[model samples]
Target: MTSAPITAADAAVTSDTITMPLEDVIDPDEFTPRLLALLSNALVYRESHELRRQFKLGTNEWRVISALSMRPGMSATEVCEFLGMNKAVVSRSVTRLQLRALIVLSDGPRGSRPLYLTRAGAEMHDRMLPVSLRGQEIITEGLGATEVAALNEVLRGMLARIRSDAALQGAPGSPSQYPID
Candidate 1:
């Protein structure tokens, strides 16, 4: 089973570039990968805007907070590895969060410090949780529980496949990071 190719004019989002005409290659509406990227981008854009307005938080900072919320005691290196984010960016966010008194670090051997959320950080995370959940609810409004579960199953499988592919191809450069699982 294959989807028909859609032209630039037909899909309006087949290609990112505006100067060149997008060929009837892949219809983002029908293509799973393109659809996934578009949806992820939409979610990130929304998060970036809302977080900045609501919490004065950048996407990077929120990402770090999110990782820590799920897995406490993660070092910056561990966060970078898990989130596939740039070390420098994560470092800066960590510093900012620390400055805000939202996060604290535990001393470790050889200057390796594990990150932990402060009382205020946890409170902020609690507040932010509803926002994220609401965004998810909005996106899944028409879908049944079973359908959403199936979609997650598919996405998880895709993530696993991509990780395996990346392992085979070798790690990407520091400038490019893998998707956070």
Candidate 2:
């Protein structure tokens, strides 16, 4: 059966006919996506912050360390590709991690390229991995396995759509579809 139309008064009240909570009263279309994004980002930031504190490393350094943990020796370009980051940012992060003795860079076959991660980097990653897993568990506590899978599929589809639209807009000679930033 189709749902009934929502009136302003119905939207403002709970099932018990009492005024809904402030969060519940907000317009869904106006605030749901923003709220969800902010909440997701906040959780990520909090976990990253805790990891940094435990490992004595910044977010960028942690990313480099984590990348190296997966593979001991990766070039800058490889790391950038894995992390979806630009070269300049990766270079700066690598330099800082190297200076801190968390990672060591050795010359590679191609023009003095560096392969990264020291013993300290591995240790930090090991220490923080459990915490990260715990954080993830907490975030997904109420979600059933099926629900989690469904959410993942939905989010992936949304990301693909967004990326496809962006690419189409950025293609040259496409009538300048979107106003360039």
By lDDT, who's the top model here? 1
True lDDT of residue 5, candidate 1 = 89
Model 2 alpha-carbon drift over 4 Å, by segment: 1-32, 171-181
Candidate 1 lDDT tens digits, 15-56: 655776668667658998788788889888888888889999
TM-score of 2: 0.68
Cα error, candidate 2, residue 27 (Å): 4.1
Pairs with backbone N, CA or C atoms under 3 Å apart (clashes), candidate 2: none
Give each model's whole-structure lDDT: 0.85, 0.72
Best by TM-score: 1
lDDT of 1 at 101: 97
TM-score of each: 0.78, 0.68
Off by over 4 Å in 1: 1-24, 173-180
lDDT of 1: 0.85
